[model samples]
Target: MPHAKTTPFAMPLPDALAHVDRVFGIGTILADEGQDIVAPYYVQSEPGYKRVHSEKGCMHMALNTDGVYTADGYFTQIREVADQIRQVQATRVLELGSGMGFNTIALAPDHGQVTFTGLDLMAHHVSTARNDAGHLPNASFRQGSYTEIPEDLRGADVVFGFETLCYAADLDAVADQIAAALAPGGRFVMYDGFRRADFAAAPQDVQTAARLFEVTTAVTNGFHTIEAWDAALRRAGLVVLRSQDLTDASIAGLRYLHNRSARFFRSWKYRLLRHVMPKYLIRNAVAGLVGPYMIEGAGPRSGDTMGAITYSVLVVEKPR
Candidate 1:
């Protein structure tokens, strides 16, 4: 079992595939065409996100900067949002897909003068976030999708979504909405998984791993490339300020999840529990197990360093 020392994955790509196949056959990993599974997926996966991912209710990836996994890694996206707030001197912030109000709640207390609004598609998530944010007068949560931001919520100084935009069905429509929602000179930040520009050229196994990761997490249509997002934003009359690949920083946390998910496949007890659990919830293990392989390529043995997907940050701004 050879490993890629450059990556945080412990098992080789072939071994990882075997583990996933043992639990959920690889042939059955993809969703049927035009399936509306995102909302239900989140509903079923909330508990898992709270327990396995973060107790604070973070549903996004933990970004480790020094190649070490730590609880602080969860705050990486938060810090980026906070920096944008200060940079823009923002008084109003809107977070798209603000799951459980993690980002808004964390920033509201420190910026007392700033008002924070978090919009999510899940009513359960909004209810939970509202409960969690009861103490913060400056923060509020609403149940809504980013595809059609409400008219009253427009003119925000900062608009961001952490690991949520990948669920977007139409990039052009969402980009237009974001541009319309932001005030002049306002910033829009998104952190999520994206297909590499050369995704079609990647190995078949790597492509399969990327698609498996997408379907398990309910991104049934698949991740759009960064280039597609950038072009869409520009067409909507926004400036693309940054598009940084943070895949290296995500390795440690992804590997941690991969190892944890591997346990469910290796143990008879955990495997049995899958029958009792919600199908979407139990299938999360498939995403966690294949996540690292999709982003880090098969392994050193394959001599393929070009991965099929990347975790990245894209920043754009509405013109003044």
Candidate 2:
């Protein structure tokens, strides 16, 4: 895959922004098997994702099944997440990029005996998560870069690195940081997108133009094959517990919901970007590009093609 033409000039270059750990673990995550992977999207700046995920319509797909914002469904989904975590028996668990702290709230009961730390890269996200954590007694919010998170995370019973990895340029460091932060016997729960089983004709501009929809940038470094992600996890001293191809299930579901919720899919939120910014420059423009895609007139770059459920999810564990 071709690297981005323009490298970001930020302190923790997007590559380094993965997780803020000063030191790295000794073992390496191995991609012994070669699998061609592609990150579904890109972003020129952080605003790229904030605009779309924060939006009312397009956001449901990103947050609900993808693990972005709080669920619009009900406590059942939250319970499902808790079931996954409780089974792990994580005493000190940390979620890497908790957007609105929904997961934190959902897992609040677990935190009664479980110490949870929710870390986020965005300021508003941290503030909102902190506000969400305000009522919780065990959880705390921290405003820090993933690149330098402290060693306190080293022995966590459950360490999660969800789809948020896609935003990092260097997945190696991301893996290193996660491994270093894990408890010797803890499990590393990972859920990410996978490559399509067959090659779909892609636009040469898929990499560049896709950045127009920045929300995809946060969880997916790019669309990767299950094999590629599997290899990375193994290399980092973690073993795959269970993984399955959910591509078909997710795609089918998104298409169903999208069609069913077509009205909300184009709600007034679609036309209100100008109120927030100049509308020409910023994520609004990207949202405009994504609008048509979500509206059913997809020209290959449609919503069905670029969502979280589009890929498979996995659960990997760090052995004692």
Give the alpha-carbon lDDT of every model.
0.88, 0.47
Q: Poorest 10 consecutive residues of model 1 by lDDT? A: 1-10
Count steric clashes of candidate 2: 22
Tens digits of per-residue lDDT, candidate 2, 69-183, equal 2335323323434655677776788877666566666677655888888787767667767876787888887766556667766677776655555455555667677878877
Segments of candidate 1 deviating more than 4 angstroms? 1-8
Question: What's model 2's lDDT at 318?
Answer: 77
Off by over 4 Å in 2: 1-81, 195-221, 252-309
Alpha-carbon lDDT of model 2:
0.47
- Indicate which candidate wins on lDDT: 1
TM-scores, all candidates, are 0.96, 0.61
Model 1 residue 42 distance off true place after TM-score fit, in angstroms? 0.7
